[model samples]
Target: MKILIVSQFYYPENFVIYKIAETLQKFGHDVHVLTGRPNYGYGYILPEYKKIKEEEINGVRVHRVDLPARKRGRLSIIFNYLGFWYNSRKWVRKTKLKFDVVYSFQLSPVTILSAGNLYKKKHHVKHICHCVDLWPESVLVTNAVRKKSLTYKILYSWSKKLYRACDEILIGSPSYKEYFATTLQIMDKNIVFVPQPSLVENSRKIKTQNLGEGFNILYCGNIGTIQMIEMIPEAMKLVKNSLVKFHIIGMGPMSKKLVNKITELKLEDKVIYHGPLPSPKAAPYFKGANALFVSLKNEGIVGKTIPNKLVMSMAFTKPILAMLEGDGKRILTESKGGIFARQDVKFLARAIEKIAATPTSELKKLGELNQIYYAKHFSLETITRKIEKHLR
Candidate 1:
């Protein structure tokens, strides 16, 4: 199949969609990516490719579109979306390429809306809308869109239209699937529960056991508002005098806020912020950690969103300490690799202690179970096969 992926973010940007596109390419599908230049991440852009123009990064063909360089405010974000849409439309019209399927990842609804609309109109192709988060929910949490504003209603209506127009809708969590089906009155056949895959390519490199001296609790990936990263400070306070060391290795909109909180709490000695490490270097942090932490915003709506970090931690066989209590907790409980605290500092402290006191042998077994479960259920190979079956 000739597949065209239109995403707001991609490789060297520390996102999973890049790896997913590449993996699909490996499976004998011709994959083409239409994306904005690497924009929102702590990673540095490639020196040569810094100024955006279409170029092949790997085997997959990529059409790099231009967007507003700065991503600071509402006006800037809107401009960025417009820029991507404008450039992407020009590229698509100029090239006049026909694809078997058009798949787009959503961050700003505008880019996908433009491409999906173009593909539907020009080539009469089937569109697959892969939604990582519901728009208004994400925008509200990020402060990008106000709850009851005109902009919010417009984006919400557009999101619903995009959902309805697509041949299939891929949501990251089953909770999202249910919400779309029941709340939005979308048909069951239109929604597919397709969780994101971890960027763990070399599973063989992941050490099954921890050799580190202390219990290192690692929280990786974005530390944004949706993550509720401030919980880390309180959770650290609960386990301060213990043998556990908290390591946070990521940056986000809340990075400065988290750093300030850590300093305020005098947790600089206990909590080490390593900033953002490359994808390859991040493995050791997970491998050495006795447990990994997963958090979601303390909201009823946020309970349904599953951050991709959890699956990566599971892939490394690291026991998880989930701080949210919805679908995330459900997955953790079903896996039996760890326990959920549901945003309670005391309970999180106790959960860490329980993990700390578990015998190394039993911990090792649980770790293996975690890896086995991830391989069976969440690996790209498994996921793509499911997608293929659905496509058929």
Candidate 2:
């Protein structure tokens, strides 16, 4: 099958779609990506992508469309969203590439799937939406608009229409099903729960680096607001074990504030910041750690999310220290793979303390349990097979 995967963000933006495309291509499908220029977290488009257009990445081919940089402000974000929606439509219409199916890697804006929907409608092909985010519900989480507001009402209606047009919808988390059935009034759609596969490539031998012995706890991914990185220093303050150390392996908007909190809490010696490193490069740190920390805010729709970081941690055989609620916490509990906390600073401190006190062999056993569960549910091979079945 010649499949075209449409997404607003791809490649350098750190989206799972990049992995999906590559995997699909490796599965003997001609996979192509229609995505906006690489400009996500950094706000501005990277210099290398400025004028470059269509090209082959690995074996999968990629098509590009330009969009406004989602710089700092709310207005800029709106422009970026609308820009992709508008430009993707133009690109789809002009491209001569015909595909057997259209896979929509939907995230953030529900309309990111619009290009796939458009192509599906025009070519009379199948459109499979991989929905990772809910629209109006997301607005509630961000406080972007009130439920009764005109903006929310409009997005709510539009989201329903777009989703209904799809042949099937894939939910990244099982918690999303209720939202689809209730809020979107989409009970009849072929909505299947497909967990986000670990973006970490665990195929290669993990070369563990020494993270300075005394019980190193690892965290990888964005150090942004929702990540609850600020609680680390606060939690460490309560933790009785002085030998336990934290190693954060990513950077984001909250970097400065997180640093200030670390200093204020006088945890300079306990917390180690490695700025940001690529996933493969950061694997050693993940492999070397005594435990992996997964934290998220315990508020509204966001809490219901099964973060990629949580699944990614399970890819490596490491005992997890999960601090969140809903789907992610449920996964940890169900697998009996790691210790859980309910987004409380004191609880987080206690979880860390527990890991510090546990024997290294016990921690490795917990990691093996996580790996067993991940193999059954969240592994790339498991997910790709599910996707390929649908694509066929």
Candidate 3:
């Protein structure tokens, strides 16, 4: 099968769609990615990638479209989205490339999939959309937008059309499937639950750094209100276990705020911030830690959705410490990988101490359970085979 994978972000700048495209190629499909210049990690587009529009990296052919570099402010983010929506969609229409299907890895802003929708209409081929984030509901997650407002209502209607245009809609979790069914009104045989595969391999290693002496709880990813990462400091202050240390990696708007809270409560030694590090650089921290931490703001549909980090964390063979609700909590519960807590500080503090006090042997058992569960449910082979069957 010839497949054109559409995504705003791809290789060079870490995203799971690149791995997905590679897997499809391994399955004997001709996979070509239509993406933008690699510039997501840094605020602006990297100088080297700015001039290169297209190239083949690791056997997969990539076609790059020009997009505004993702700058820091909210207005910059909006421009980045609008830029991709216009440029990628236009590129698809004018390109000579042909394929049996067009698969879009929709991370956010439903408008990105509009490019795939146009190709499907012209070619009469299947358009399979992998919805990493739902539309208006996603917009509502930050709490800045209101459903009653005309702007939100317009976006809601637009989101539905783009989704319905797809021949198949791949939902990240069961809860999202419900949202599409009850809210977007597009629930049918076309919609299926196909969780995204993890990019982390079982054997990649990075240089180990100082992650504290005792049982360290490592949290990696965006540091912001949406992630509820601030809870870490508040929870640590309440934690009586001195052995339970928290190591934070990654940066966001709330980085300073998180530091301030830690200082205010005098948790400087307990909660150590290492700033932002690339995945390869952060690998050692994950290796040195006794357990991994994951969290999400329990707000609306976005809260119920399963985060990719949860599935990715399982591949490391480490116990998980998740503070989330809905599908993520249920999956971790079923895996018996680690402990769970609500967004509250006291509960989270207790949960952290509970894991710290568990015997070494018990912790090892939990990590092994996580590995087993990940292999069974969210492994690359399991998901790839399912995707192959659908591509037909």
Candidate 4:
């Protein structure tokens, strides 16, 4: 099968598409990516990639189109999206190549899937829309837009059209199935629950580092509004254990605010903020930590979402300290991986203390259980095979 993956973010930008494309190629499918030049995180295109370029990554083809260079701001982000949407639409219309199937990695600005839907109709092929974030609802919860606004209504209507056009819809969490079925009136038969695959390589060994003497709890990935990172410092103030250290290993819009809160709370000694690190560089922090942290703001929309960091932590055999409800908490409870706390300072403090008081042997056993569960459910091979079944 010749498959074309349409995604706004791809290789060299730290997304699952890189590994998914590689896995499809390994399974004897001809995989190609239709993506924009590397511009995420850095907010500018890389030096090597030209406005339009084609490259082969591990036998899979990648076609990158030009994207507008912009800083991190509302207007800048909108311009960037417009640039990709326009360029990708033009390229798709002009290209003579055909695909057996089209896969859309729906992240944000769901309009990107329009290009894939177009190609699916033109080529008469199967189209699969894999939604990582629920639109309109996510935007509303993050206060990006008001539910009564015209923009919000437009987004909602556009998303419904996209959902209806696809041959199959793959949601990252079971909770999302309920959202689409109940709210959007989409049929449950067309929606499949397929969680995101772990990025951690099975054979890769972490060069563990000595992270001093204490219960090091690591929180990785994006530190954004949805993360509710300020709660970490607030909870730290309530924790009595002086040795329980909170290590944050990422950067985002809330980075400065989190740093300020740490200082204000006089938690400078208890919390350490290590700026963003590449996935490989971040491994030691995960491996060295006694437990990993995952949280989201207590909102109805947030409950339906699962952070990719949680799945990666499980692959590393790190017990999770989750302050999340719904699908995320369900994963932790079902795997017997770690303890959960309500999204409150007191409960979070108690949860941390519980982990701190537990014996190292018991923590190791919990981590081992998480590892076994990850292998059975969230491993790359397992997820890839599940997706393959749908592709057939």
Clashes of each: 0, 0, 0, 0
Residues 1-392 of candidate 2: C-alpha lDDT, one tens digit per residue: 99999999888887787988898889899989999899887779999999978889989888889999988788999999999999999998888888999998888898887888889878999999988887778777767789889998999998899999999999888888988887778899888988778877563487887998698999888887778898898888898887999989888778999889888888888998888887768888888888999988877666778988888888887889988788998899888879887677888888888888988789889998988898888877789889888877
lDDT over C-alpha atoms for residue 222 of model 2: 80
What lDDT score belongs to each candidate, Candidate 1 first? 0.75, 0.86, 0.87, 0.86
lDDT of 1: 0.75
Give the Cα RMSD of candidate 4: 1.5
Assess every candidate by TM-score: 0.90, 0.93, 0.96, 0.96
**lDDT of candidate 3 vs native?**
0.87
| Per-residue lDDT value at 116 in model 1 | 69
Candidate 2: residue pairs that collide: none
Clash count, candidate 3: 0
Clashes of 4: 0
Cα error of candidate 1 at position 296, Å: 1.5
Tens-digit lDDT string for candidate 4 (177-243): 8788877788844898898897785624778756789899999988888788888999999999989
After aligning candidate 1 to the native by TM-score, how far in Å is the CA of 46 from where it should be? 4.4
Q: Write the per-residue lDDT of candidate 1 for residues 282-336, one digit (tens) a residue.
A: 7877877777888886674556666678888888886777786677777777788
